[model samples]
Target chain A: MKTINTRRTIRKYSDKEVSDELLDRLLTEAARTQTMGNLQLYSVVVTRSMEGKERLAPAHFNQPMVTGAPVVLTICADYNRTSTWCRNRKAEPGYDNFLSFVNAATDALLYTQTFCNLAEEEGLGLCYLGTTVYMPQMIIDALNLPKLVMPVATITLGWPDEQPVLTDRLPTASFVHYETYHDYTPEDINLHYAAKEALEENRRFCEINNKETLAQIFTDIRYTKKDNEAMSEGMMEALKKQGFL
Target chain B: MKTINTRRTIRKYSDKEVSDELLDRLLTEAARTQTMGNLQLYSVVVTRSMEGKERLAPAHFNQPMVTGAPVVLTICADYNRTSTWCRNRKAEPGYDNFLSFVNAATDALLYTQTFCNLAEEEGLGLCYLGTTVYMPQMIIDALNLPKLVMPVATITLGWPDEQPVLTDRLPTASFVHYETYHDYTPEDINLHYAAKEALEENRRFCEINNKETLAQIFTDIRYTKKDNEAMSEGMMEALKKQGFL
Candidate 1:
């Protein structure tokens, strides 16, 4: 519980190597996490070699953590192994569809988080790369993922080199609804975002970016309309190519 | 750590109530979870009243846990709140797309797993209902979920009335690959699944279903090709209707 409350994403790592025995132990324990129908529709491709990390760095936008961490894990939503088994047993596989992709992806993510929590509890540091979905083709090529297998998330892991402050979040009331969703009104939106917009760091961020408001920093600079549309198109194409569309 | 390793799904619940104070505390702590850019991008709808549970029961295929548990939580991927704040701050929103939906869904799932871990640690029991995505339109109507908001998962929570055995998983080797994905061969597949197929429970399951093999039980009865295709179509329609296309 304390680990859940005090956990922070670690981006920087020391030069310590993560032993195979420890990594295997943590993953084995995390594999005990509950899954849908006990299907366990997920797999992880671990990259510990410097050459392998370098191959994956471009897909992650060359983030320092990709090369700096001792271990880089590309967690995938995998139906390949399952489908192969089904075929061998004379069962026609039906998991090459969109809903199946969502199911497998959910399983992969849940397993990733469980592994992350266990890793953090072991004093290992890690950061999740959001770029995994942005460029799936490159990751697929780099990791040699076949049909029915798609990378959903990437984590860079090693011993901690720095302790960062916890990130801020919207108040509980902002995200929790009773019985049903209570749509946010203009006043409610303002009240919910007041503290976040007023943060000194956020104010400085807008000033530095020449933005009019904190929200503009997100909409105009961080996650722009043009980029989101393009990325969405690319993701759809990748999903189709992977036979999940 | 022990919590993660020993946790099992709890579908049956006692008559004892879950205190609102305790629920809020757990949620607040779980909110500390890491997310993409700290955007959060997720919401939870808490259903406590019997009428609300009954309304949602059909969506979850009338699963007894819907009405049996002390509380049901519909965890959602939401971009409405953030977009509203952006509009209020003189910023244009552009999150009505698939990539944005994926990001929000990932955030929601990570939060769900983190909350489950913490809840299990506190001796509270919960089970995830995979039916959330299969009938999204029904849940949308029941929860009054608006545009840019989609329910991605559901959890029923309460004091445990039954202790289920730990679910079985394929060997870690089946899911973990070093450096790159080593595609499974027919021989490799047989080796990987031998233990699972050899289980007496699975053998009995196949017999009960009148199936030739374990995989036939899943392909023919549990997750059939026709059902998966139909559900995939339905899910895509719901995503479009929810403005995530």
Candidate 2:
């Protein structure tokens, strides 16, 4: 509980290396996480070598943590192994559709979060690179991922070299609904975002980005509509090429 | 770590009701989980009333845990609140796309796993109902979820009435790839699944189902191709209806 409460995304890592044994133990335990029907539809690719990290860095948009962290893990939604086993046992496999991909992705995310908590509990820090899904084709090629396997997320891990401040979250009332969803009113939205918009750092961010409001920075600069649509197209194409569409 | 290692899904629940205060604290803390740019594209609907659970039970195929547990949480991948905030802040939101839905779902799943761990640590037990996606339209109508708010998974939570044995998992090597993915050969597949196929319980399961191999049970009965394909069609329609496609 303490670890979950105090955990932060660590981008900077020390020179200390994470031993193979420790990584193995934590990952082994994390695999115990619940899955749909005991069919663990996930696989993790461990990138420890410099060349491997360099290959993946471009996929993650050259994030410095990709190269700095001693270990980079690419969590993937995998049905290949299970499918193969089914075929080998004279049972036809049928997990090559959109819903199957969704289920596998959920299993992969559950395993990813479980591993993150365990790694943090062991005094290790990590950061999730959301770019994995945005440029999944690059990751799939770099990792030689086969059909029925898609990269969902990436984690850069090592001993923490710095302590980052805890990020802010909207009040629980912002997201928690009782009995049924109560749509947020305009007044309710204003009340919920007051603290966030009032943050000094956020104001500084808006000024530096030359944006009128913080949301403009996100829509106009960071996650533009044009970019999101293009990426969505690419993602659909990749999913089709991977036999999941 | 011990809590994680020993945690098991509890389906049967004691009648002791979970207090609102305790649930609030855990949900509030779990909201601190990492998200894509801290956008927190997730919302949870807390269902405590029997009528609410009954409304959701059919969507989950009338899973005993749904109506049996003291509380049922429908974890949703929501872009409505964030998009609403952006719109109210004089920013046009362009998150009505597939990539946005994927990112929101990832955030929701991360929150779900974090909450499960925290809840287990507090001596509460829970089970994840994967059927949430298989029949999402039913849940959407039942919960009155607005557009851009799609239920991703459901959790049945309460005090435990039974302590089931820990479920089995494949050996770590079966899924953990070093440097890059090493495709499993036919021999490797046999070697990895040998123990699972040899398990007495699994063998009995196959015998009862009148299947020759354990994999047949999954391919034929549990997750058949016909069902997966039909569900995929429904899910896509639901996504389109939810303004995510």
Candidate 3:
């Protein structure tokens, strides 16, 4: 395994292309990763074509990486395969449930992360476009996805042009539990920020902004209900339409 | 990256002890894997003590690996650290949402997979216990986990006692999509099995007892609602209590 210091998100990319051979290799390794019952409940949609990336970019909040990167892969939660297996065996198909969605979605995301690690090991930069799953229809139309599949997330890969700083992390003890679910009290939260402040040493995303602590800043930006309601609605609607809800 | 064929779950461990230096390196490297916004919104709880395992085994469905393995680690979904960053600057911590849960959970799971991959590279056999997260209280009490620190999963590391067959996967076409979600007709299901039969030459999982198509057996299992309802309900309830719902 590569050292942690070498790992960082590569937003900018070199003009170099990620070949079809490499794509296949990565997907195959991804498939080899663990999944529930060896069901292989997910698939990676490799988007290297210009036309494909053009449509996929807008669906992911106009993220430049979606099209700008040489390689973009979308991991999807799939139920259609299992459903079809049931029909052929003359058994009942019942995949539309909260559990199945979580199971498949979890599998897809795990595979995507495995692929990302492999890409990084091969000297590539990558970024995961979390919003890709929200605009299911546009991406589906762009990528020509089959039925019983829904987007979990999209990852963009290429050689890095920019070196982003090591982003902030929560404290160690604040999150690690000895045994049970350890709820964070106000004091615990305060201690975490103090440590983060030490790490930041007054530095903002890059420059010193003299802003609120990382906690305050992120909370304001991350937790507002308005930021995600539409995205959630779109995802659920897409799933329902696909008979996966 | 290690070759895929070498990876296996180690259930029966030898008396040989795992070094703390290796354990620390594992946690450090694993924690550094990519996460949304570099949130690093998770932590690893490591246990090498016999007493610790004794307490944790019951929480994890009494899997022998929990107590038997030389090393066991639990990955957690953490919001406390992020919430603290908010409160430190006198800001409201609003990261408790479905999206937050999804992001943190995915991040934790990704880190866990990377850790597993790393462990495999080091010649360790790993069995990921998917049931750890299902029973929160047992884990919390056993591990002394605090609130907002939910258990995502557990893993036991040692050597393999069982060499399970390399499980077959649904075809690429069965799960992969070109652009959108594809609807599967009855024909699609039969066609997938036909291709698999050709590849496997009669060696299949569902067809072991009789001549059955992959489509028929899995469809019957996946489409049933009653099989997994209790487990699903328990998981949702645990999440809700953790402020995830």
lDDT tens digits, residue span A195-227, model 1? 888899998998999999988988998888898
List DockQ for all candidates. Answer: 0.87, 0.86, 0.47
Candidate 3, residues B130-227: lDDT per residue as tens digits? 66655666776677655556777688887555665565555656665544446677788677666555556345655664536544444445325664
Candidate 1 A-chain TM-score = 0.98
Question: Per-residue lDDT of B1-245 in model 2, one digit per residue for the tens?
Answer: 67888889999999798999999999998887899989999999999899999999999999889999999999999999999999999999999999999999999999999898889989999999999999999999999999999999899999999999887889999999998899989999998999899999999999999999999999999999999999999999999999999
Question: Which candidate leads in DockQ?
Answer: 1
The residue ranges of model 1 lying beyond 4 angstroms of the native Cα positions read none
In angstroms, give how far residue A162 of model 1 lies from its true place.
0.6
Clashes of each: 0, 0, 44
lDDT of 1 by residue, B110-208 (tens): 999888988998899998999999989999999999999999999999999998877677999999999999999998888889999999999999988
Model 3's chain B TM-score?
0.81
Q: If scored against the real structure, what TM-score would every candidate get?
A: 0.99, 0.99, 0.86
DockQ of candidate 3 against the true complex: 0.47
Which CAPRI level is candidate 1? high
